[model samples]
Target: MKALKKSIYAEYDVHDAFQKIVLLEMQSYDGTKKQQLKAFLEDMQRSGCISGMISQFIYHADCKKFYIEHLDDLEDIRKEIEDCLGEAVKDRYGLPHYTFMCWLCFEEYCYDIYRNSFE
Candidate 1:
């Protein structure tokens, strides 16, 4: 598992201060990718990481991708997902090749822009 490129949607960043959107792509296997992704999402819900935050879980079967919108810290959510994937790998669970994209928030974008300009 690895993380892919990051992106930012200005509207979401400005309007939704406490939330973020993420795209996760997983390699398909035996047509069970959706089920596996749902299970992982359930695990996240049960573990209290996404207790009241997750707003959406959309799966695109044709591309084996998921779009998740949640109100949790972006880095924290990414770490949790990576940790779960690591565990799955260790257990030899149907490890689907995966990648994650974390969209930046307004404040984050400002900071990044400032830093880049200075550098």
Candidate 2:
């Protein structure tokens, strides 16, 4: 039983999760912030930056004003995300540069090639 378990985790390469502030804003995407949302999506598409499935929502926030303040910072943050995800995904799928998945960091899922087992 122990030997079997050791074999399973030898290869694992991605798992990324972080507390996101923009997720709160995305919840109301269909409603009031439609215009802003359109612009944000278009900008990302044009820049070939952050693009992926954004589901599994959990928000407990209430604000009369939308989160317009981060408009400037959003581009920088998304560019970082794009860099991390890399262009490999685009080449693999033969898709446009704007297409991407929420792949976690490499270290978290990297296979320990040298290790016989994680002792």
Candidate 3:
């Protein structure tokens, strides 16, 4: 809940180590927030969330800002997305279903991943 700063892979948990590999294999970042975002996008792609190249995720996905800022593991990022979506829906502020865009982005990214699979 506290932004996941306390748990960066949980002291070499195998699954956690694999998560780092997943992100690294997806894109290269200099340990910056951009890396976190790209990693999230890649995770979304694998999980059937959103799709195309990393560029598209950066261009249109509203949730990039949140991921870039949060810098947590995938599961926590996902929980936060759900919580944010609920809050965004409740409030009449920002864009219509503002946080919902994250969900939508995931869907698009998933489609992109599927489409690319055949190529």
lDDT of 1 by residue, 61-81 (tens): 211233233333444444444
Q: What overall lDDT goes with each candidate model? A: 0.30, 0.29, 0.40
Quick one: ranking by lDDT, best first? 3, 1, 2
Clashes of 2: 2
* TM-score-based ranking: 3, 2, 1
lDDT, candidate 3, 50-117, per-residue tens: 23333333343445554344334433544554675674223223433323444443343333333443
Best by lDDT: 3
Evaluate candidate 3 by giving its C-alpha RMSD to the native, one decimal. 13.9
The lowest-lDDT stretch of 10 consecutive residues in candidate 2 is: 57-66
Error of 3 at 62 (Å): 12
Candidate closest to the true structure, highest TM-score = 3
Give the lDDT of residue 89 in candidate 1. Answer: 19
What's the lDDT for residue 40 in model 3?
52
Each candidate structure's count of clashing pairs? 0, 2, 8
RMSD of each: 16.2, 16.0, 13.9
lDDT of 2 by residue, 16-119 (tens): 12123223423455644444444333433343222332232111121101113222232344454466668432335443222212222111112211122233
Per-residue lDDT for 67 in model 3?
38
